[model samples]
Target: MDAATSGTEDKTPHRFHRSLSGLGVIILTLSVLSPGVSIFVSGASILQQAGTGSVIAFLIGAVVCYCQTALIAELGAAYPTAGYDYAAIGHAMGDWAGATTYIATLINMPVFLNLSAIGIAIYLAPFGIPLSATMITFITIATVTALAMLNIRANEMLTGIFMLIEFAALLLVAAIGVWHAQPDAAVCVLNPVHLDNGVWIAASIGIIGIAVNNSSWALAGASQALMFSEDMKRPETIGRIILIAFLLTVFFEIAPVFGTIVGAHDLKAVLANDAPFETFLGQYLPAFLLKLVSLSIAIAIFNACLAGFVGLGRTVFSMGRTELFTAPINHALTRLTRRTDAPWVALLLLGTSTALATYIPLTAKLLLLSGSTTILTIFYVLGVYIGRRSGRTGARYRTPLFPLIPLLGVGIVIGEAVVLWLDAETGRKSLFICAGAYLLAFCYYRFVLMRRPGGWKMRGPDDIDALVARDVVDA
Candidate 1:
């Protein structure tokens, strides 16, 4: 028996139904990206910082993400599993590094889910709904968690419907901006400027760089394709799915952002508003349409939360499949809803954790942690480089330019990390906190896991042939 499969006869090795087509995975991954939320939040930040220069900023962000994607795509195709970064990094780097990544994810994902859930309240407020942010958050969490508990294909269908609504909202935003183009808007894309106080001034390179960093968050999540690899019919196509998702995400997100920047009749006022995207829409859209857009935004946030819950459960499910935890705990986590194969136990744990996270008072701290979590991509890219150096390149979809692309990705991520650390109030502390979590993870692995009976063992996804053979025997 393979080491990866040993001691699992009692546990019964489980496999995903693998019924999802490539398009199904793409839709689910895109839901995870939540283009609408990305634009409304991260895109708005870029516009505020770089103004017309946001065009350049997002373009730069796209380049950075493209490099990162090459690394993600290659590794994802190689180790197609629900474990995602943990599996890829562990196989490429080492168990210690993979543990660190998993720990970071453990810290970051709940905070993000909390944030996404609460945002639904803000979008719904325009509809004259009277609900506290906390109340809305709990409700959103419950709703999304319930939806996430459904079978994978059912969730995909629901998210697909919600995705269409969000896309319409994004398309409407783009139309409003492009249809009402401001004079010199084209020039602003080339020679960008921001509103500084009452005067318009050239956007400094540093400011544009900040915008790029913010924009990267908006264009992020395409690598979420990693989460559904085990569910796909053709895992080999995962790389193409990731790249396609990134391109579409860039187009969907950037069009609305650039359009809003160019179409604004009053750039100064739009930028000044706390809810800039809302303010922008209010200027051009009738009250009814604005309300509809607001409703769509609310749906978008809910869709994102649902998709996040689905992925988070799988992450936990993957973690449970490893020898990192005690047998009882692992057995509990790997429990499935026999009928649908949903990770019910993992989903329940995620829901409970997310609910508790929503109650965390230090929202600013959570936000800071969320911002700095982008550092995980650096570890991911390094894994690709390490794998290549060791000639462990069994992946069918190799990233072009070999070491150059992965190296450039590392450079960009490190630069982002340095920038985060340099910010005294928030970023610095966030990185310190992240470093502490990693240290704890390393200690656990080095001192604890290494001393275990069988030591740390890595498991890849079950082979397709083996799965088929097993099914035949059972029948």
Candidate 2:
């Protein structure tokens, strides 16, 4: 029997093709740039309120994201599954935990897609596009649909082109800032300010949350790259790719913050204004070039939208294939055209959900909440704990300082959850929403889906190795 028809055999085939060595660099760059734009734009306001200490906040958050990335990287190298967090959590924890995390991921897809769509619409408004909410939704849906229909290689090429545009735009801004640098400005923005202890702590926590929200987007897709591991000439190379991408992202994420803090003395003014970077460009650069830059940034919003859609599609496709949802969804996802091997059903679902999310109010809040939910549910801490408990016998990439690093990850996540709980603005309602969604999914799974005769079984170490080997053979 064909693998697809044989219940004992894995049906998901690895048909990925190798591309650029710098694929991780490109993906990371795009991931960082896309979210970095929104963060700089929105985060300026928070930085203003928090003062120069915002830099410290960002540094702390970046470190946390790196820790999370490190844990996932190890997991990804070992499993090399498209299922990513769903697979990792399932393998490390249990089916229930994996199912819960999967549901959070599902919710996150729409939240991010909607936020990207809104961001694109807002960015374009300055160009006299007059894009309404409805138009934005339509454009987002249509564009994503068309792109999703393309082959995987085509998608990568399109993403690479968009990343180039984004990189150039960011480079231009950095150049302008450097040329306009004031000698008297501070070397860094983390200057200490006198404030009451309670107020200072509260402000710092809030700012850290914002930074985490921004930087986490880049780190979010680290596992997604593993989905393409079969295509890599050396699957182990994904580890290096992830490390390089994240380090580069660190530099890119921090550089502009330093420039913005130095250039704009009035953080409040910078924050309150829409498109602070564009405004900075207008004041410091030539008028015509400023317009061009603004257009580029607007186009960047679309780039982010498209990239988000692609990631979301792959994530859902992976989950469906693993039988976390329904067998029909998996069947649909695996029904790729022989020529391109792109699943149209998964793509259509991604586009439809993204378009729908655009209409939701408080999209930015939804996005942040969604990210937090995923991080919490997936529990990088739990993964590390499990790995250490399993002993280092079969580890492909063992994290240095084993127990400590993993323990630290768990502590940080727990600490962040506690802080969020205390900060009412960020807590209560969002947690409730996430909880309610998971509970509903669990009910459905327990009552209906689990009764299915055939589904993918959650695998142990030997089983996972077998699965990976099978995929390699199929490829």
**Backbone atom clashes (below 3 Å) for every candidate:** 0, 0
TM-score of model 2 vs. true structure = 0.83
Instruction: Give the TM-score comparing model 1 with the true structure, all chains together.
Output: 0.93
Best by TM-score: 1
- Model 1, 1-475: lDDT tens digits are 1212345543444557788999998999999889999988767777888888988888999998888877888777666778876777776677777776775557577777888888888888877778788888898888888888788999899999999999998998889999999987888789988888868899998898878877876788888888887888898788889999999999998889888888889888988777788889989878898888888999998999998888778888878777567877777777777567778888888888888987676646454464444567767677888876764443457888977887788788777887776676777777777777777887888788888977785664567325333433443
Query: Candidate 2, 120: how far from true, in Å?
Result: 0.8
Clashes of 2: 0
Could you tell me which 10 consecutive residues in candidate 2 have the lowest summed lDDT? 192-201
Model 2 global lDDT (CA atoms, 0 to 1): 0.58
> Clashing residue pairs, candidate 1?
none
Best prediction by lDDT? 1
Residue 417, candidate 1: C-alpha displacement in angstroms: 2.3
In candidate 2, what are the lDDT values of residues 266-373, reduced to their tens digit? 434454455566666666778777767666666667766666555556566666565665557666654444555555667788777777766567834553464354
